[model samples]
Target chain A: MKFVGVTSCPTGIAHTYMAAESLEQAAKDAGHEMIVETQGSAGSDPIPQSVIDAADAVVFAHDLPVKDAARFAGKPTIDVGVKRAISDGPGLIAQAAAAAADFKANPAKAAAAAAAAPTGGLATKVDSSASLGTQVRQWLMTGVSYMIPFVAAGGILIALGFMLATFALGKDGPVLITAYDINLPKDVAHSIMDSFNPLSLTWWAALLFRVGVAAFGFLVPALSGFIAYAIADRPGLVPGFVGGAIASTTGAGFLGGLVTGILAGLVARWISRWKVAKGVRGIMPVVVTPLLSTLIVGGLFIVVLGRPIKALMDALTNGLNGLGGGSLVILGLILGAMMGFDLGGPVNKVAYTFATTGLATVGLATDAVQYKIMAAVMAAGMVAPLALALATQLRPKLFTEPEQENGKAAWLLGASFISEGAIPFAASDPARIIPASLVGSSITGALCMAFGATSPAPHGGIWVSLLFGNIFGFLIALIVGVVVMAAIVIALKSRDHSLAAANA
Target chain B: MSLISESQVILDLDYPDRHQATRALAETLVADGRCTDLDLFLSDVRKREEQMATGLPGGIGIPHARSGGITTPSLVFGRSRNGIDWGAEDGPATLIFLIAAPDGGGDAHLAILAKLARKLMRKDFRQSLSDAATAAEVVEIVEREVVNA
Candidate 1:
C-alpha cells in the first residue's frame, strides 16, 4: 500500500521531523511504501501534484493553519495534532486509508459534509498549561541574548571613561587621555576642561553627549523587544519594548526590562486573537498597537512608577554609602545574596535594576556612594553560568552531549554577563541546578563587593570589568565563586540519580 | 525496481482527514490484490504511529505503515489544495509521501530511505517533483534521480 502524509507544528522546531522519521520507519517495517513531507521553517519540498495523484491515502499532523487542502478534493486525510502526528503518525495514516475506502463505497453522505467544511481549519486548541514552562524558558533566552551586547558596549565605554579620567589625574600615562579626547573629551588642560564642562563650556556639546547616551540607553530595550518579537512572533515585540523602556527609565534596570519583554510578548499574543481584517491586521502590529501601548505604558511609568521608586533607589544608595568597617561586609553579603537568589528571576532582576539605577543616579551623578552594588550583582550573575558550565564539563557523565554543547556556550555567555546562559541547565534540572547557581552567584557577588571592586559601567561581565581596575581581586572573586558553585553542583548531582539519568 | 507501481496508484480529488487518506490508499491497494484485510493494514499503521512523529524540519510529512496488507513496497503521493497541518516546522504540509515496505526487508528498505533522504535534500529535484502533475512523471523523476545518484 502506498500512503502520503504531512506534518507541521506552530513554531516548527522539534516535533515535525520526529514524526516523519517514525512513520517512515514504521512503513518500512510493515512491508509498505511511504513518503513523508515536512511543512516547517525551511518550507515545503515535495512533489505535491504527483503525491496527490498517486497516493492511496494521506495524513496531516499540524497545529497552525496550513494551506492547499483543496487540491485533494476527493482524497481522505487524517488530521491530528503535531504531537499526535509524531507519537502516532502511522496509525493515523492507516486510518485515513480505511476512511477513504469507506467514503468511496458510500460517497454521498461523507463527501457532502466534508465538502462543506473548510480545509486546514480543523485543529485542536493548544493547551496553555502544558506550554507555560516552555514559554518562560523562551522568554528568558530572548532576554539573555538581548542583554549581552548591552553589557559589552556600555561596560567597555564606561571603563574607558574611568581609565581616561584616572590618566588625566596623572595616575597613568597620557595615552588614555589622548584616546578619550579623540573618542570623547580631554580633561587635563584647564582650557579644554573648561570648554567642555556643562557650566563653563558650550551647552550644545554637553546636550549632544547626554542625548547620545540616552539614545544608546534606548538600544538595550529596543533590542530586547526585537529578540522577544522574533521568538514569540509579531505581537510579542510591542509590549516587550514598552516593558523594557519602563524598566530602564524607572530604575528597575535590566531585570525589569526582562520582565517587561516577556509581559509584552504574552500580551501581544492575547491581543492578536481579536479577529480583524487581514489588511488592517498589518496595521495592528506596525502602527496602532505599539504606538498606543508605548504611550500608555510610558505614561504609567512617569505618573505612578518612577516617583515612588526614586525614593527607594536614593535611600538604598545613601544607606550603602553610609556603611563602614564590618557593616560593609554585611552589605556585601546582602547584595550578593539578592543577586544570586533568583539568577535572572525576579529577585535577580530587582538587584540588577537597583544597580543600574545607582550607576546613573548616584555613581555618575555624585560621589555620594563609595561602593558599587550593581557591579557586584552583575559579577555574581556572570559567575553562576560559568560555574555551572565548569561543573558540567568536569563531570561529563552528569550531562547529555547536547547539554555539554550548551555548557560551552554558557561559559562564553556567562563571562560576558549573559545571565540567560544558565537557562538550559535550569530548565533540565530546576530543583537541583537553580539552588546551586544561586549559591555560586551569591558568593561571587558578596566577595567582589567586600573586596572593594567598583565597576563604572552600568553592566558587564568579568572580562570588561577586569580591564577597568582592581583586576587581581576581580579574578580571585570570580574563580572562588565558580569553584563554590561547581562543588555544590557536583555534590547535589551525585546525590540525585534522576538528574544523572535524565541527562545521560 | 520501479519507483512506484502504476496499477496501485490513484489520483484523489477528495480531501478527507487521515482516516480518509488511509482508506483511499488501502482501497487502491486492495483493488490490486495487495492485501486481503484493509482493517488489519489500517490498525497496523495506526499502531506504528503511536511511537514517534513523522513531521520533518522542512515543510513536508511522510506518513507510512508496515503490514502484511502489502505484497511489496509501494509509494503514494498526495497534494492538498488547502494544506493540512502536518506537524512541519514551517507549519502545514501541502505535499505528502507515503511509503509502505514489506515486513523484514531490512537493508533493502534502509537503502531506499537513504536514497530518498539524499534526493529530497536537493532543492531543484524536490521542486521538480512537487511540480510534476502525473504519477508516471513523479516515478520517472524519482527513478531518474535515484539512478543518477
Candidate 2:
C-alpha cells in the first residue's frame, strides 16, 4: 500500500524532521512505500496534486494547521499530534494501512464520508449532507440546465442559416455566406447593412447565422455564471460571468468557464462569511462582496492560472505539430480523441486548428497529408453528437425530456459538422460521455486516416459531399464511430452510475 | 570559518542547571565573534526553552533559536560526563548541542541542524560523539556526520 503524510511541529525544525524521518524509517522497516512532506521552519515542500491523488491514505501529524488541508479531504486520513509520529511511527503506519484496507472494503461508506467531509469553502448548504461528488454534479447540472436554452436557440439558428444558405446559393452557399457571418470588417458590414435587403433569403441567412454566433458567445459565460449562482447564490454571478467572458476572450472555452465558475463561487461564498461592522454590513452583500469577490477571482484567473493554461495549450499544440512527422494514423487517433474529449473546448479547438492549418498549407495539392488529416478530423468531430443522439434514440429512458429533445436535434447538428452539439450532454455527464466519445472518436480517426479519405473543404460533414475525395471511406468511418460511441454511452448510462443518478 | 571549533566545545560541561551551561556555551559564541549581544540572544533561547524544554530521550539536549544578535549561524557543543538534567523524561542529558542561526538566514543552517537532529536519532552517531576524547574529535564526528558545511 502507498501512503502520503505531512509532519509539522510548533517550532517546525527538529521535531518536524524527526517525525518525518521516523515515519519514513518505520515504513521502510515495515516494507511499505511512504512519502512525507515536512512542514518545517525551512518552509514546506508542497506535495504535488498527482502524488496526493494517488496515495492510498494520508497522515497529518501537525501542531500547526495543515496548509491547503482541503486537498486531502476525500482520502482516508490519520490525524494526530506531531510527537506521536516521532514516538510511534510504526504504529501510525500500521493504522494507516488498516484504514486504507477498511476504506477499500467499504467504499459506499467511504464515499459517504468523503461527501460529508465538509469541503473547504462550501460549509453551509443543505446539499453538504450529500456526498462530495453529488454536490459537484448538482452544481454542474445547475449550470447546464440554465445554459441549455442558449444551446438550443443558438445551434438551431446556425443550422437554419446553413439550410437557408444552401437554398439561396449553389454548392458553395455555406462557404460563401459564412464569410458574412465571420471576420467581416466593421465598415464593410455597416456598408452592407446600409444596402440591406430584408426580404432576401441570402441576407436573412447571414443575419441568422450572425445572431446565432452572438448567442453562442453567451453559452460559456452563462454556464459559468449559473454555476457560481448555484454555489454562492446571487453574489457569485458577477465574478463568474466576468471570468467566463475572460475565458472566452482568452480561448480557454468551456473548461475555463467551469473552473472560473467553481472558483468564483468559492470566493463569493468565502467573502460572504466575513465579519464586518454594522455600517459596512449593509453594503457587505450588495457592494463589498461583489466588488471584492470579482476582483479576487478575476485576478486569480487572469494573472496566476491563465498563464499555466495558456502554456499548457501552447505545449499541446506544439506537441501535435511535432507529431505531424510521426505516424499519420496515430496523429488522427490523437486528434480524434481530443475532439470528443471536450467538444468545443480548448482541446477540440486545437485538433480543429491542426487540421485547418494543414488545409491552409495544402494550397492546391488535394493529395497532401493535410487533406487526409482534414477528412479524418471532420469524421472524428461528428462522432460525439451522433453517438449521443443514437444513445438517446436507443434508450430514451436513460435521458431527461430536455436531453432527449437535445438528442433529436443533435442529429442535424452532428451531420452538419457541429461538434459542439454534444456540449449539453458532455456538460451534463462528462464522466460517462467524454470517455465513451473519446474511444469511439479516436478509432474513427484512425479508420479514416487508414482509408486515406480526403476533404478539400475545411468545414462541413456530409452536407458538402461534392468536395469529399473518398466519400465511401469517410461514411464507413463515421458510421462505425457513431455506432461504437453510442453503444459505449448506452452501456455506461444504462447502469446505476453515480454521474446520472439524479437524472435516472 | 567552520560552524563549530575547539573553543566552542567543552567536554566537561557539568553545571547545576541548564541556564549556566547555556550561558557558558553562549560565551564561546560571543568569543568567536558570532554573537553581537549575549544577553539578548540568551533571553531568546530562554524564551524558547520556556515554551518547550529542548530535551530528548537517550541522553541528548538540543536548544536552538534564531536570534537578531546572531551575525552568522554557529553551533556550540558540550558534553556533561556526569549528566545534566535538561528535562528529559528518561534521565539527564550527557550530550548537548546549542544551535544558533542568523535571523531570516534559516534555510542555510537550519537544514544542517535538521540533519543533526535526525542523525542524533541514531545510536552510532551518539556513541561516536560520546566516545570522542578531544573537542576536535567531537567536531570531526559532527562535521562528518551532519554539519559538513
Best by lDDT: 2
Best by TM-score: 1
Residue A280 local lDDT, model 2: 96
**Candidate 2 stretches greater than 4 Å from native:** A111-504, B81-83
TM-score of chain B of 1: 0.78
Report the C-alpha lDDT of model 1 over A7-58, residue by residue, as the tens digit: 7654332345555666666666666677777664334454334446677667
Q: For each predicted model, how many residue pairs clash, with residues at least 3 apart or on different chains?
A: 122, 2
Measured with C-alpha atoms, the lDDT of residue A320 in candidate 1 is 65
Docking class for candidate 1: incorrect
Candidate 2 is scored at a TM of 0.45
